[model samples]
Target: MRRKLTLKDIARELGVSISTVSKSLKNSEEIGRDTKEKVQAFAKLYNYKPNNIAVSLKNKHTKNIGVIIPDIVHYFFTTVFRGIEKYANSLGYNVIICVSDESFDKEVINTELLANGSIDGFIMALSGETQLKNDYRHLTEVTEQGIPLVLFDRVTDEIKCDKVLLNDTEIAFEAVSKMIKAGRKKIALLTTENFFNVSINRELGYRKALEEHGLAVNENLILRLPFNEQIDGIYPFVSNNEIDAVLAVNEIFAIHAMGILQSKGMKVPEDISFIGFTNGLLSKYASPPLTSVAQHGDRMGELAAKMLIERIEMNFVEGKEEDFRTEIIKGTLIERESTVN
Candidate 1:
């Protein structure tokens, strides 16, 4: 079977510019008849197919960017959107936002809706369902067309493009180490399923910290919860375990577990120390407040927007190959009333 050929491949093989190949394929008047024939014949021989989305985007420049987030109500996602909008607007670009609501189908539909030559590029976080399903055909389609995409926070390695991420493992290790230093031995990890890349890294950090501190990682203490749902099993999990510290992947889980434990006569930082990710309003306003990791969503959004815009502009440059990048933002742990100092 013949390997699929792209515009770049055809241009390189025919010793012509990609723009010339693109125009020739469409029989544009800009190309000489002889050159057009040569290009067309080569393409026909290779069974070359043009990506309609790529053709439309390369033919016209759109000063619009599309951003898709998993949930609109989440504080972290909202902050990230703010940063993206702020940076994109400063560059004289309009931003269109879409909420995936943690659904894989919604994410795919949103990508299709925006990839119709409406936007120059896309910035998105993988939806929970998208990660769970581990299918990234929609993302791969856009990238295959040479469209710029930047995934932040909830991201996957299946699709290769630019990405902005938190140093989840390092920060999680720091958080767990702090709890261990505070004389908490039986540390519990409350996280989403391992399919989510961020959760997987954080869990690695959690286990690393426990092992490094001479504490055995107890499987019973690890509670895997469903993403974006009201947690139900926290009470039973806590009641059944002798946990001295809890590390939740997000503020929602930390706050919910703390509230439940407090109602059960547990004192924050004394009976059990609690720490979660994303230092949002819930972390600040929760009873006794919660010590949390600041994921710096705003900075992540700004970086993602910057990368996507750079890629979009670079597409116009002749004969340049895409150089993908992954930018990591360091997270900070905020001390609060929930954890012992």
Candidate 2:
């Protein structure tokens, strides 16, 4: 591994004071133009990246944001993360990423750990299991200690913080309405997460759409999907359910639902229609091309990061303000053969 470059190395090489090198690199106007130019030239030549931790300790700004995600392996979260990182870099900031893998304790611990003097703010997406308890006291504690936060994806309205969320229920309502208009009466909802606010909102939308069209909302048609689902049983579950249409809370779940429905001697469009969430890549090449709810994961992350940074910059330069805000993005429903009748 290459050794990390430091200020001392730059100072020794350039025969300048350590303060001169630091001020020039940090773009202090006090340094002479010719001297700043030379320092910058050397920095670029050596690919010297300054230590943000040390700078933050001295100047009270890390130029770094901490990101806490439930699962890094999830396509949606990763896509959002990419957007956050892209925008953060454009604004001259670095990212400190941590994964909690749906554990509440891990989420709390990561939040506390990253809220140290190392970062100016935090952008966090809560884990699935976090719905059971609202021990958001730790998050509040971070905010109280003066670290700005803007939440992403799995946000809660009760927390009194800024958030980024899909207009999930509206999209669900749209999907259900479209399927109904296409003449599919019995719509089944297949979801892996049954407890989160997103899932609950989706179900409410499904019911609202059905009610608007005078279609009966049968509880039996709605299956409570458990986390530990079996791969092979997917086929039998769809076959035995006898559902005419399916709406999924996630894209991967919807894609597999289509496969299972097709395997059990059931024909899509003619017999079943599907609409899933996230608009992931695999949904594009599914056998019949799955219809999906396109959650703009990247844009969501970027906006959340932008908001967090704005808050941090404001708080650091001026002072903390009470007028925090929220952002809710609309989800688009993309049509495909799987959901067409």
Candidate 3:
């Protein structure tokens, strides 16, 4: 009874990255001739066969792109989808979308389902639970199996794939600095746990802005809310804190805080100012029209799609190797009625 060899096993045996083993087994020119021969010999000696999904995908052209997002209800996700569909369709391809609902299990399921000969490639954002667990084996498996994958927004470095990102830290810094310049002495951050990369970056920006302005970084002023918790979950923190301004990581928190403040007779931009991360519908239509850092989800999606399509078309030819790229899109600070004029 012998076990089948996997990419990780081959990589560990050869003292190389899983990506290197994958490319080598595919006979990519990116791998040195010596390494490629060694890897191929090892694979043959161990009876290693590529995953059926990857083999099937490579043998046929589905002309369908699969996308998995954390939440479809989110304005940012919807906008990104629009951009992906627009670009993919223009190139004579269709898209299949799945919602992970912030669950790691769902993310794995969606990816596996899509990979089973249904789509040509994948574009996704990491789920909250996936980030919390810090487990990217499912994503890694897809890549190791020679599937083209592109990650956008909530991405992790553990998976070597093309990524589209927002300059979240820079965007948050600018938004927080705006509040500080408006004389906000006690600014606070409303965010999720540091497990989420986006939240962590925004928190960093928040801290950087305060420290650069000679303001003390108060640990107590930072509130980490549960992901997608009810609006009421944020009430007690805002009620008890003396925060003159708040930098929320998303529109949900920012809009919820605004309602809570108004209910407590605190006027926006008068007693407490706020700036949120996403410049979506809520930010634009909220009472007082929330000031926001407009992360261009559409542009990120377009770029991500473009990258994935390019990789898919490359198709791992004998003389070609994929060079993964990470594209960072800058955000714009949209001034509105939520902040002081």
Candidate 4:
């Protein structure tokens, strides 16, 4: 069986960049005539075919929008998708969703696949791998090509575009402050690595709360867990620390810690209270409902969709190209069984 040829393949075969191959094939004047002819000859000999979807999208308005997210399994992301779908549908735009599985390569491929004129604009959340690598060349390319883009939840400051975000730091500070006021002297923070902007903000808030309360910061109590590692991996950290309370950046961490604490003969809200970000199903359905900071995923999605559409419509204007806005959505702390209420 033979495999289909792609720009990447041609670029590799010719010792050129994917961008050069694409431009050469398009008969772009930016590419030298000799190089363009060479690329075309190679493509012709190999029976290379441009993506039909991309070809169709080049000259016509498909009224479709592309949405790229890290993963669909998370409750918060699912809720956000619902919001995007509802608002985009109401505006007579169809949505195409692509999951990157938190991979940098997958994220790049999804954007390249969808950006080929298939969708009018893009709304996305940065994948964990994208954040970790700090490589946003794919995103930068999309914006440079004059595509309307909107980032939500997990976003970067490098790209100038419409963004929807939760005031994670402020809300986290409030949540941690509440715990401190409830007599929790030693609070441990369970979070992902600082690669994630949300986690960094939440950790900063946690530190700020402790400092303002005159509590000593214990570096040993701060556990930076890998994103998707099992709950059992947290046992060592929990066992070694004499934490009076725990604050996790996400519901999964908080719930897992709670289970471990109970198994070790600790009572929820009695021996050690807990709080987490993202008021998702796990937080609500745990053995004892969790107190958490709700990020309002639905609202963020709605705003992201609205912002993208507005940019698409305003794209025709000349001077408006420089205009960009970052909208911060306020988070609310929901009191529940995990905390002293």
Winner by TM-score = 2
Best by lDDT: 1
Clash pairs, model 1 backbone? none
Off by over 4 Å in 1: 1-59, 228-230
Per-residue lDDT of model 4, residues 1-341, tens digit only = 88888888999999889899889988998999889998999999998987655654564556789999999998889889989999999998889999999999999999999888788899999999999999999998999988989999899998888899999889989998999999999999999878999989989999999999999889999999886665566889998889989999889889988999899999999999999888998888987999988888899889999999888877756446777999999999999999995
Tell me the deviation in Å of residue 317 in model 4. 4.6
lDDT of 1 by residue, 196-235 (tens): 8999999999999999998888899999986656488787
Model 2 TM-score on a 0 to 1 scale = 0.88
RMSD of each: 12.0, 2.9, 13.5, 11.9
- Evaluate model 3: give its TM-score: 0.81
List the candidates' TM-scores in order: 0.82, 0.88, 0.81, 0.82
lDDT by residue for model 2 over 1-341, one digit each (tens)? 98888989999999998999989998899999999999999999999997766767888888889999988888899989999999999999999999988889999888888887778899988777676575688888987887888887777765767888888888899999999999999898866546677888899899999999999898877766765544454556676776889998887778888877677778877888988887888778887888988888889989998998889878856865777787888999889888774
**Per-residue error at 76 for model 2, in Å?**
0.8
Stretches of candidate 4 above 4 Å error? 1-59, 228-230, 317-319
Clashing pairs in 2: none
Q: Candidate 3 on 77-182: residue-level lDDT in tens?
A: 8889988999999997889999999999999999999888798899999999999999999998898878899999999989888999999999898988888988
lDDT of 3 at 332: 97
lDDT of each: 0.90, 0.84, 0.90, 0.90
The whole-model C-alpha lDDT of candidate 2 against the native structure comes to 0.84
